[model samples]
Target: MNKLTLLLFWLMPICLYCQEDYDFDALLDSTSVLSEQGAYEQCFQILGDLRQYLRENPDKEKLFFLNIHEAYDYTRFGYYSKAECLFKESIQLAKELGDKWNEAYAWYGLGYVTQDKVLSNSSLPPSEEGKRAFFEAIELLKAEGDSAFLVDAYDAQGYAFFLEGKFSEAIEYGEMALELCLKLNDCESEPNILSNLSEYYLAIDDFSTGKKHLQASLKWIKEHPGEIADEIAYNVYRNQADILIHEGKIAEGEQLAMKVLEYAMEHKDPYLLRETNKMLIDYAAARGDYEKAFQLQQTFMSQLDSLHEMQLVLSHDRNQTLLNIGLRDKEYQLLGAKLYSQRVITWSAVGLIVLLLGLLSTVFILNRQSKQFNAKLKKEVERQTKELRISNEALERFAYVASHDLRTPLRNVISFIGLIQRRLKNHNDADLNSFIQYAKDYANHMNRLLNDILDYSKMGERRLVATPTGIDLNQIMEKVFPMVKDDFREKQGILEVGLLPTVYGDETSLIRLFQNLLENAITYNDKETPLVAVQLHSVANGHAVFCVSDNGIGIDHAYHEKVFEMFTRLHNMEQYPGTGLGLAICKRIVNDMGGEIWMDSSEGAGTSVFFTLPLIEVEHEQQSQENGAKAAMAVA
Candidate 1:
């Protein structure tokens, strides 16, 4: 009888723990339903309540799940920093508790948030950090023998690969994910995985395979209708339309594309709307409807611009919300301080009248401070709003310029191709050669334009944060001179090099800057013999300034700064045979290196480009000495 009692006692805690877990799981299911219904705030409130209860109860197991859900919720709302912090905390807690399932989920949440951050900030979609996190999650889930979360992990891997443009790997992983979903009997996830696979196949131009996957996804969506069904079906239909359009089923593709647009509008999915508009624009262009195509293009650009503006607004709102929360916390602290002072006054109430006067003064001071804080917050919000508006307007103007400039060359290419095709039927070799040459020239110009544009845009992403490294500008110039040596020899250009100094910067960017300037000097010169000279001099604070001067057909005073604006060409394509992106690229590269670049030129005179760079060795030595002094002071 004693032994039986001992067994029951031992089992009691186990049974209680299981019951607690069950209760938490049920609440989690409710939260999932709310989230799926798009009631994120309500879902968050429920999660908050659960968290409060967990805080009171102090259950490590329950806290793990709560943190994971909260982190994921934050990520969904673009609270990347908060989500990242929570995910890291949850991961540590899960590891301490030996909860492998929650650990995997935490890692997956972190990865998803990182991916979203990359996508928001960059045009490119590839994310190495996200891929690593998802792979780690997959391994953990596999070890746990968890089929449910494993499906998601596999799908995320596939999605990452797709973004990275690894089409074959994406298709393989997508198939693996779909198979797992089917095996797990997760009908809701199965359709989305199939849709993902279809998109992958479409990316690789495998229309038949893409069609097959789309059919499968459509069948599943129809069989198991849910909120996810609508979202995934929208993408599936869009891909199907794309495949149809590629296969010459124009009317059918247009119909499907229109349906996708309608669904996107109903759901208010801006991304999907933009994608559908792009498809419609392509269709119009294909059907030889230039007017319709132009209108659709304008609408597409407007929508894209608006989407960019909306993103800025959302980011600003998030910051504003955080600021308000901080203010509330500060108010709470001030209230606590007031209460403390009042308590002290009450305890020391040798004179009740003095205590009353003290309380009154405290109240007045607190009110004034609160008013001041509120006023400051209002001013900050207004300033940020104005700055955002200015940035958006500038971006819109840039987009217009880019579109107009890029389209002009493409239009020429198309016209030349059409001419070649029509004249090819007449069997005239001479005309064919001329048309083909024109097409080739335009193609080369387009290639140069695209390269320069890519370089300009990638400035923000590349290696721009490292400490300056010492490099000899003379060696850089020598290396660059060879690239334009033929042009110099052909033009009989007299290239003079003064004593160039070693400076600190990205060597590749510096070389490209010199190469472009020299190329421009040679290419733009109409003189029988061109003269180009480069010289350097010492500047303040361990810096060297350099100037590249050329006796080429100089720029007008009015167009001096304009030359640095992208695609601002004064000469026609026939005369220049180049895109007007070189100076702009050079200026951006110079600025990125913590230097300035400007032109000193006038019409009929020579042009001179000047820039500066830091002297790296001297700067590094000075920084070391300063750090040592700081450390010595701290120790003292």
Candidate 2:
């Protein structure tokens, strides 16, 4: 089966509920079509509505099935982690209901969804977790004697084996699945399995058997046209033509190949067209048409070269969608909270009015107490107003800087794209390639800038809720080293660690802080022997001070404060490469943790980055103080 057909099959929702009762068949069909057409937002909106409806109605079975579909949708579109979580939920739901059938399907979903590697040796599973899930699924389905999903499970295993290069195992599994499909009268899967088997046979050099399977698949397609997927039918034709060409049936093979090529061109399927061109090249070579072969090979290479550009665009779109989805989730949560808060405030105002009416007579008698109450209320309101203003101003400033920085890279990309287009028209391959590479670089830079902006915006949102468990600096360095090990090796840099202390902070944030500081230390250095030293200072006043000293070209005192500002860069891109928000993020993280971060250095001298983290003992002391105050209040 072709990739599109396989994706459609894999994403097909396994409905355990009655479509007539739900009256959602039309909706499901529409969403499925939209998903297939790559209109993910439309699909998501429809699915989201269905999800909300299910939440209100509380149908566990329908919801579970819907979750599988949604998970598969995400999986098909490269959202692996999100898909894995949803598949896990589906498994749990099926287990809770003791529904082995659904559980089996859920496990099957997880097997494919969570498998990271495209292929692995039979000696080692593509993904051990995925392999285990597949086995568990097969066992459960086999126990229940359920052949409907079992056929699919077997087919999946066959594909898995094929990808692993275990051809014998793949054939075994494929035959098993085909047998089950025939027994169940499942025409839909039978043809696909036959086509798959034909490929396997061809790979093993059993042309006779391969031809038989291909012929069988074609016969099925001709007989059951409505049941066969378009891509599957196309594959059957393509493979048959390939076999014919290899068997010296040039005229017949060329006709079939041309038909397939026409279809691919009409559908604008560059990949399939490229494949057809390759097969034609082989046919031309067989016929001793060397000139035609060379021309076809050049066309194939051009198409193959364009695939990277296609992939780059696809990657950008997927990333943008993921980012938009994340931001939307945050916005939704904030909107919900704001709505709740507004409702509370509205009710509170009504209550306050009623209280004022009831206490109108007693107000004059309690004037002094009322005055104190008014004073406190006014002070609280003023404090909140000031905080709101500061937040607004900060948000506005961030937006401006983010837009400007983001637009600069985008402009570079657009300008280079135009250059490449013009060069393409002129047929200047060298200029076109140069401009294409530049555009790609600018796109990458833009992506990085956007990520940095996102980080800066999110820093305040996560207001460092100090965890009770302290973070060990040594462990953090160990964790962070791998991320920059290549850079360190490339620069021949050395790092020295000293005795470190446990500090109260968020581990993830601290890791980012240390990583940025260390990276900058290595990146900015012009020393003959670059060295970065991390050490702990004596604890004082409930804080643990630390220093990351580096033998690098030091920053001047004039630009020290500017370094902690968003998008602030003291050096040009040629001299240093970064989004310039790393130190800003580090500063925000430190301040959120109730600590300070600063640099102590001057130009031409080595730099030392000093930061302080709250001592774990200080957190304990604060907790004790809070407990004592609560006890005193209770006694009073």
Candidate 3:
């Protein structure tokens, strides 16, 4: 009887553990199915239960699974911070357990959450950490020979690059994912990869390639009906519509676009609806249906505002959810502590007192730390606010200066018009004609000033908001040279361009930058045979300095610094006609591109305008190697 009681006592825990393990496995299977079916609430419930079980059983493998699933559940609800914390925990647990597969998944989850966080906050730049995480996950999955998950990782990385405006890189990764998906006969990701490829190609202005990929995506969807989601199908259709419109197949494109609009409306997806309406607006404008375009524009604006409000609400809800989760965790901890204290007190009152004192100490330390953190945060906020105020004051000063400058042209126009009106009664045709021309010139000057001001303001905003890409200076010069070739021809001047390097910048801005400099070089010359030369001045420290030199009526030393100021001219309008905004615009563009521009000249000496641009190192090196090889071949 004694042996039987001892055996049962020992066997009881083993039996319970086995039963618990079985239940855990079943629950995990259920969670997987529920997750696949998009029943995230049920998945979360199971995950919570598993979390509680793990607290008691302490199974590393089961804990990793619980963290991963719960992290994904939180992620789907936009609780990114929670998801990130859970993913990090899973990563650590997976590493401890030497589970490469789950470790790869945990890294992938972390990267995906990071990507989501960046996407949610437009102010944030593309995440390098996210990219590194994805790379780690991909390498591990490759080592594990897990091609299925590898496809997802590749697709995700491609999408991340796409969001960052790295279209070429995006295309490269998308192609890899597509090839793998095709080889594995994985129809699930094929359409998505193809659709994404189309967008990437289109972004780089490879319309034919983009159209081909769009068609392939559509065909894939047609062949694999129900495999693709409704959202994906509509997105593919929208791409097709955009391509067709670009191809001038207006009727067909509009038809497809209308279909997408219907789908968006039916689904009540504000983003899709606004996008479709914008496309329709463009279509209407193209067809010269201004009324329809206006109506669509109104609708698009309304949808945009609604979408912004929805985003705000979603953000608030996510923050609230995080707060509630924290509160619940604290409540659980307090409940557990209370129960522990009760059990300890049952054993010994003295031990209970010690436990209570320890709890109080922890709480006091945490409260003090929280207070310090709050104080630091408050100081940081105040510092930022002061900086913002200074920036705003500077902007106000700029506005005041701009308005003051603008009034000069207006006054000239008014004065000239009054003179013309008074002289009309005197029948003075020559004076009247001269006054009219003067008025026209001032009005034209005002127009030019307004356009330049707009460009300056827009460029500043664009520099802050737009994603820059690799721009070949050679290509930019090709576009810019043609624009100023007429000026060169008229002056009968020689315009020489040296070999240019590729740089990281906005294409349009770069083109404008060169155009302004080249035109300035040609326009400012006083010599009979003006010589304008564009040459690579120097290259060092990942920057290329280019010099645009001109045998012009050079700027005086006294006026060199002032020349870049807005509407500051060295010469009169009659001698050298301009808004004087050229150098100002050039300076703004150079500064915005993280470079400097300055002129080296005396009054009679030829001016050399030197500017720096960030060099695309790989491209510059390749070019140099090619040049070296050519030189060797020439010697041979």
Model 1, position 324: C-alpha lDDT score: 51
Best by lDDT: 3
lDDT string for model 3 (1-636, tens) is: 245334433443343434334456655666666666655544554465456556667888888887887787777776665678898898899999988998999999999988877655533343455558888899999999999899989999998888778888899999999989999985588888889898888778798999898889988888878988998789888889889888888889989988887787665566567666876787789889876676676566555544654664455454554444444433443444445445444555455566877666655565565556556545654664565445444443454456456767776766777676676756757755664565566566666765676676566567767788898776676667668777877888777766677788888888889899988988989899888877689998898999999888888888888888766777778898887779988998888888999989988788999999998844465564454333223222
Stretches off by above 4 angstroms in model 3 are 1-22, 28-46, 121-127, 258-293, 321-636
RMSD of each: 17.4, 19.4, 23.7
Q: Candidate 1: TM-score?
A: 0.48
For model 2, state the Cα shift of residue 302 in Å.
1.1
> Which stretch of 10 consecutive residues in model 1 shows the poorest summed lDDT?
627-636
Quote the positional error of residue 94 for candidate 1 in Å: 1.2
Which portions of model 2 miss their true places by more than 4 Å?
Answer: 1-33, 45-63, 112-126, 131-133, 258-293, 340-636
* lDDT by residue (tens digit), candidate 2, 317-369: 77566555444433433343344445445555566666866454444435554
lDDT of each: 0.70, 0.71, 0.73
Question: How many backbone clashes can be found in candidate 1?
Answer: 0
- TM-scores, all candidates, are 0.48, 0.48, 0.48
Candidates ranked, most accurate by lDDT first: 3, 2, 1
Candidate 1, residue 67: the lDDT equals 80
